[model samples]
Target: MGLLCYGSVGGVMASLILVFSVMWVGGVGGVGFHERGSVMKWSGIPTALSLFAFCYSGHSVYPTIYASMADKTKFSRVLFVSFAVCTINYGVMAVVGYLMFGQATKSQVTLNLPVENMSSKIAIYTTLINPLAKYALIITPLVNAIEEWLQVSKSRFIGILIRTVILISTVIIALTVPYFGYVVALTGSFLSSSATMVLPSLCYLKIFKSSRRWGLELVMILAILVVGVFIAVIGTYVSMKQIVSSL
Candidate 1:
């Protein structure tokens, strides 16, 4: 776990450096920060919102992380720090990527990188490794749930087999689907939004119903819930429409 975190951080930093370098090292094989993109494209907003939701997809494993923390009171602080660091990292990457590639930027920024540059190569390799490093951590909770449901939690062989099957299934799905961007958007809209925004708010309201009244906090949570539902519905609809049309 420690090594995974360290390697991911290094990969992220390396990618960021490579992106920044692209701004100066122009004309090698990729576009420079020269294209002036439009102010806003309202048509793309739904997909963009879904992708943004994907950035906070860690909600599923958050409970496990909080439970494992020895210092329970500091969970909020830890979550805040984590979100802040991630937001800064993601925001910087998004801005740098847009500035570097502008209109030519593909959904996958690595694809727009100068293929021959050493920095680009480093960034590409690190980006590949970073996700692989996180795959287990992100899905472990789900895997554990499956094991328990199947009454195989105590069976080492069964657990390994289940994990292997899941891995293979995911790999096959990834390879089979050409519309991964749409799929990601759907996952974010349908799952991440529910987990991060809808579920948390509902859980809070349910648990605190006895003590809480119709006050500002209740209104705030309800507002969040409405926003979550809107994003989920609209984002999912747009992404699904695109996927169906492309097919």
Candidate 2:
């Protein structure tokens, strides 16, 4: 995890491994058209929308990546490259998984892979590594935010404590949540959607109020804000309904 977070090489290698493993599963399969299902269930729309929002919710770590860059001017390039790679990875995985299992596809693509296949094992192993590799990136910003809120900067130990506390709380939530699908949908709808889509647009408008307040950018951002809110509201309703129904 440390090596992956602190070094460029590790991230690249891990990403390549992920991409290859996923593609390998697809390549070895001759999934029937039955697997490539023709119908979509209307009930799954909210879950699908929320999960897509979750997939792209990396905005929290953008500032850290930007500040750490040696050449800040290339930050745009970095974003372009990162988004491109993510798009490819996500696109391929979605296509392959749908082709393989269609409506039956699990959130963990490896779960849909044939358990007897070597490619399935590799993909599953790679999935385990991915969260560990990204743990630092995921936690750093949150830790910083907490520390800043408390104005506790003098002690690195305090930051570690905060991280530990947060991790422990997360574990408790995981154990108590009862269902992973509910958790994912709820987080994506409320937290990820707000952070990734709603907050940024509002912040941009607020910050640039004296500048391009009424330009083409405003129109685009407003459109995004509306769509984001709609997703958040409908997704949250569906997710909450599922959770209550299960209970």
Candidate 3:
């Protein structure tokens, strides 16, 4: 479980760095230090900062890890080690990606990179690893939903049936929508906000009685909620526009 969790987090961090780097160089304005062609609009530094913050928000996984720990006494030590490892891994990848892409590290960096180049290997790995990781992630939620349904009805057969149905539905959707990234992004943004921000704050408030410091936490939670909403709204709008324009 630890290894899987580490790999999952590490892979995600590497993939995100590549994604943001590609976006930055592709005029997405996140990491582009060069002030070229109206960087004042969506291309500004604020957008870049937001993108970085979003990427670093992977730290939200710590609470889940801590919660699942059998030995709570070693929780802090475990977290420190895990975080250090993840940070080092992420930092190395980000640096390499930045160096490899130089100025053109936009969102689709992998597609633009030469397959013959060594850096392109990272792109390939990112492409392959991300979907597998996403599959694992989606399955967890699906399985939990099935388990809950079964528990509520005390019917193991019903759980199995529901699981089968979900698996079939997923396959059908995957086949119907050749582009699954949009689906993943939509679900990720919504769930990430809830799991990482709102739920954590609530848990802290309830467990620790941090009402005095709750103001700041509440503000941060609200910010995350707003960002999640922004991502969802803008993503939907842009996708719709693209589909319309293409038609």
List TM-score per model, in order: 0.87, 0.86, 0.53
Give model 3 RMSD, 1 decimal: 6.9
- What residue pairs are clashing in model 2? none
Ranking by lDDT: 1, 2, 3
TM-score of 2: 0.86
RMSD of 1: 2.7
What digit string (tens of lDDT, one per residue) describes model 3 on residues 123-233? Answer: 567676776664544465556555776574477777677768877897788787643333444444445444555566566657875653658766775576576556545
Which candidate leads in TM-score?
1
* TM-score of candidate 3 against the unseen true structure: 0.53
The digit string of per-residue lDDT tens for model 2 on 16-39 reads 786677677666544433464556
lDDT scores in order: 0.78, 0.77, 0.54
Q: Enumerate clash totals for all models, in the order shown.
A: 0, 0, 8
On residues 1-247, what C-alpha lDDT tens digit does candidate 1 reach at each position?
4444565466556545655555444444455556678879899988888988988778767777776667789989988987887787778767777877786778787887777887677667766776675777677788988998998999999999999999999899888988777889888898889988999898998898752587788889989899789879999999899899989
Please give the lDDT score at residue 31 for candidate 1.
58
Candidate 3 C-alpha error for residue 54, in Å: 8.0
Looking at model 3, the pairs that clash are 21-105, 22-105, 22-106, 22-107, 23-106, 23-107, 25-105, 26-106
Model 1: residues with Cα > 4 Å off, grouped in runs: 1-31, 210-212
lDDT of 3: 0.54
